[model samples]
Target chain A: TQLLEQSPQFLSIQEGENLTVYCNSSSVFSSLQWYRQEPGEGPVLLVTVVTGGEVKKLKRLTFQFGDARKDSSLHITAAQPGDTGLYLCAGYSGYSTLTFGKGTMLLVSP
Target chain B: DTAVSQTPKYLVTQMGNDKSIKCEQNLGHDTMYWYKQDSKKFLKIMFSYNNKELIINETVPNRFSPKSPDKAHLNLHINSLELGDSAVYFCASSLGTGLGQPQHFGDGTRLSIL
Candidate 1:
């Protein structure tokens, strides 16, 4: 079984602070995806990184796929209260369902 | 418009009771999936259907059956629900059974087995 380990399961920061969450795994994946879920709502896809050493930026959120394809990271710059949510990293193996991480819950306070 | 929607946003029932959660997607996608989110917030895939055909069935129990009557609908029926079955159930739709395609998700059905 492939396991995706995420760091800093819970995070709380003041506005304008920068935070980064990491997802690591021993098994390599074909692609990686990041999702952000708000309270009482389903997760919305933030970005999908397919190649190794790939980086995609969406507004203040930047996502990077590991060089080995076994890890990924989401960096948020100048976090705001609206950026508070559960950030999830999912790895796709191409053959089966995507493997999701335990998730990192971010609470940004203004 | 809601791309994916699940009915009964909250379900409270007792053990041994049979319940069903309905899901529908208007994205005209060919694949749909059922995922369970535990208390620790770990989302796990339980089953997936593509074009009304069962393609991926994880180690989910037989008591939990997923029926895809059509491409736009997938329903999950649980028989004799247990306390451990209490979790958030999410329905997602994808373009196909491949990687790279983003899966749109429903708000999730919060099931509580008493």
Candidate 2:
């Protein structure tokens, strides 16, 4: 089984601060996705990176996929109180299914 | 209308009981999946169905059964539930199984085993 390990399991920051979370794995992936989930709700898809060394930006969030497809990163700029949630990274390696990380809990204080 | 929806958002049940969670998708997707999220926020895929065919079945117990009545509906039934079964179950669907097709998720059903 492929395992996606996420770093900084918990993050607490103030408004307008910038932070980044990393997702690393030992196996290559065909696709990588980032999701944000709120309390009592399922995860919402934010972005998907299919190619190695690809970068995608969504408003204050920027996502990047490593050249080897074994790692991905999520950067949040000017985080607001609404950005408080759980951030997860899932990788599909053309195997059985997508492997998800343990997720990083982010708390943005206003 | 919601793209994907699951009924019984919160379920509280006792051990050794049988229960089911229903899911429906209106996105006309060809693939559907069941995922479990534990308290540590680790999401694990339990089952995946494509065109009513079982595509992937993970290392889950036999007590858990997934039934796909149609392309748009997939349901999960658990028999003799254990305390370890308590978690949030999410239903997701995608247009295809490729990497380009992102899966849309429904509000999860929180199961609490008493």
Candidate 3:
């Protein structure tokens, strides 16, 4: 079984604060994906990184895939209340399925 | 319009009862999947179907059965539900089985067992 470990299980910060969440695994993945899920809703894909050392930015959210494809990070700058949600990282290793991390619950207060 | 939709957003039932969750995707995708999210927010894949054909089954219990009526519809049925089966079930669809393809998800169905 492929397992993805996520750090900082829970986080709470005031508005405008910057935060970073991590996802790590011993097994290498062919691609990594970041998703955000709000309460009572399913996760929505934010970005997909297929290459190692690749970085993608969506406005204030930046996602990076590790050089070995064994880890990934999601950083949010000037996080607003809207950025509060569950952040999840999923990895695909040329298989028919994806391995998802436990997810990080972020609470941004204004 | 919701691209992917699941019925019975909230389901509460007894442990011995049986239930089913229905999912549909209007994006014309060829692949659909069912995932379970536990209380700790750990998501795991349970089943996948491509064009109404079962492709992947991740060691899920036989009590938990998945039926794909067509390419756009996938339904999950659980018999003799247990307390451990209580979780949020999400339905997702993708263009293909490739990991690179982005998946669209529906508002999950929250299943609560008593």
Candidate 4:
């Protein structure tokens, strides 16, 4: 079984602070995806990185896929109160399935 | 307009009761999936249906059955629900069963067993 390990299970930060969350695994994936889920809502796809060592920026959120395709990171710059949510990283291997990581809950306070 | 939607945003029921959750997507996607989110916020895929055909079935219990009546609708029926079954159920859809396809999700159904 493939397992995706995520770091910093919970984060509390003031507005305008920067934070980074990580997702690591021993198994390589074909693609990686990042999702942000707010309270009482389903997860929304933030970005999808397909190539190794790929980086995609969406507004203040930047996502990086590891060079080996076994890890990924999500960096948030100048986070605001609206950026507070649960961030999840999912890896897609063969067979058209996704292996999700335990999400990191972010609480940004103004 | 809501792209993907699930009914009964909140479900509170007694143990051993049978329940069903309905999902519909208007995005005209060809694939749909059901996922369960545990208390620790781990989202796990339970099943996947493409064009009303079952393509992926995880190690979920047989009591949890997913029915796709058509390409636009997929419903899940749980028989004899247990306390461990209490979790948030989300429905998602994508254009195809490809690796890089972006999945659109609906607001999850929060199920609680008493």
Winner by DockQ? 4
lDDT of 4 by residue, A1-110 (tens): 79999989999999999999999999999999999999999999999999999999999999999999999999999999999999999989966798899999999999
Better of 1 and 2 by lDDT: 1
TM-score of each: 0.99, 0.98, 0.98, 0.98
Model 3, A1-110: lDDT tens digits are 88899989999999999999999999999999999999999999999999999999999999999999999999999999999999999998754688899999999999
Candidate 4's C-alpha runs over 4 A off are: none
lDDT of 3 by residue, B4-108 (tens): 999999999999999999999999999999999999989999998998999989999999999998999999999999999999999999999977788889999
RMSD of each: 0.7, 0.9, 0.9, 0.8
Lowest-scoring 10 consecutive residues by lDDT in candidate 1 chain B?
B94-103
Question: What lDDT tens digits, residue by residue, belong to model 4 across residues B1-114?
Answer: 999999989999999999999999999999999999998889999999999999999999999999998999999999999999999999999999988788899999999999
Go through the candidates in order and give each one's C-alpha lDDT: 0.94, 0.94, 0.94, 0.95
Question: How does model 1 score by TM-score?
Answer: 0.99
Q: lDDT score, residue A46, model 4?
A: 94
Better of 3 and 4 by lDDT: 4
lDDT of 2 at B41: 80
- By DockQ rank, best first, the candidates go 4, 1, 3, 2
lDDT of 2 by residue, A3-103 (tens): 99999999999999999999999999999999999998888989999899999999999999999999999999999999999999999887337889999
Prediction 2 global C-alpha lDDT: 0.94
> What DockQ does every candidate get?
0.79, 0.71, 0.79, 0.84
DockQ preference between candidates 2 and 4, better one:
4
Docking class of 4: high
